[model samples]
Target: MAQSEHLTIPVGTVGSVDSVGAVDSVAARMRALDAALPARDGVAVFNRVYLAVTEEVGRRLDAGGFADPCAAAALDVRFAERYLAAVAAAAGEGRPPACWRPLFQLRRHPGIRPLQFALAGINAHIGHDLALAVVDTCRTLGCPPAELEDEFDRVGDLLVSLEERIREELMPGPDVLQIADPLTHLLGSWSLERARDATWTAARALWALRSCDDVAEEFTDRLDAAVGFAGRMLLIPLPD
Candidate 1:
């Protein structure tokens, strides 16, 4: 594994606004991360992938792809804020969510390929953060998860589409994906579809438990740990 290091901006260095209704803020954060990280670093690879997805979401929103653009913007911003907060927290010597810890911790291992880093980050963010983001959006909009389902689906679709391209762009080769390869098996074991299904379920469960703070806390903690475990597995160093 790579030496442990933090890649997030320092707390208070950037504005702590909860969400970004405008694309400028999210774009700025992406640029900051891009500038701060080396291209070969695992976190940088994942950040590039995620930045593209976010930019596409912004373009679609501007083109009126969403029925409720406001809700979509809120959900998008809230979802991204969770990630940015985790990075900032890590940078400030504070604990980040378990799901994010592995990416930061294993960022520079030579044996771990870029695709692994990107997919592992996606696993953690979508599995844990996206569910919580849904809840956060509902709270911000004074509505329930049902009200934001459309936006959630739309965003989820974008992520799914990106996953396909990520695989295509980063996969070693068609022959390399054969079952004999460890990377192939590792990549095959995880599916974005399954993760998205589980995220939606978790979001609904969180919404149901919003009234019971204690239960919700326990549930969220478990989700974080579970997603983190998956991320750790995905980051296993592979032979060159």
Candidate 2:
């Protein structure tokens, strides 16, 4: 049960209040993820890498003492949006949008880079607000997912930076010309491939967890191997 003191809802805001029911849903979702993911038993670690990291983003939004996930998530979104706008304005050719785009082609990846820096601030706030159980579970990470609420905000920031860089430098973003071999990217000047790999591995694990139905010994064995690799991915510094 959540502590009553922690349940205090501040007044005067549009979405200040929270209910016990909403909180239960978040906990249930996490349990479902924990059970579903461990089922693969680890053999197919990389199989789900592409999809998992993006979804696991939630673990950061509802960190400590959040009785209402909606409230927690809403707060996170607002902070991220505001943070992105401010930084993008400073970085962009002085233009900041209500929402900044992330991917060069897709919808989620950030187009700008500096926005990522401001986002780090917002992430800390979310981490501080997480529930006790959630905090304990992810305690191993010096700065866990719960601390990264500004992730989306950073994405927006990057978009603005990209735009500004294009206008000012008349240059292409990040690595303008594509390399013949991706391995070159992984091992190139300050290769960010390592971070990309980590995100991919973690995302894969999440995808596998989200998809499983069978709960057997073989499944458990595979899940173990998958997590072992995923854990190692997290340890490597982002290759920038």
Which window of 10 residues has the lowest lDDT sum in candidate 2? 98-107
lDDT per residue as tens, model 2, 1-240: 212112211112223214323333333333433344322212112112211321333443335334434434443333333322333342334532212211101112233222222222212212211221122223322234445334333423333343344233422244643465332332232212233234334433333443454533344345334433333322222223
lDDT, model 1, position 72: 83
lDDT (10s digit) by residue, model 1, range 1-240: 122245555322222334334554676787788887789888789889888988988888778898988888777777777777887776666888999999988888989999999998899889999999899878877899999989899998999999999999999987666668899889989999999999999999999999999999999999999999999999999987
Q: Pick the candidate with the highest TM-score.
A: 1
All candidates' lDDT scores? Answer: 0.84, 0.30
Off by over 4 Å in 1: 1-21, 175-177
Find the 10 residues in a row with the least total lDDT in model 1.
Answer: 10-19
Pick the lDDT winner.
1
Q: How do the predictions measure up, each by TM-score?
A: 0.91, 0.19
Look at candidate 1 and tell me the lDDT of residue 150.
Answer: 90
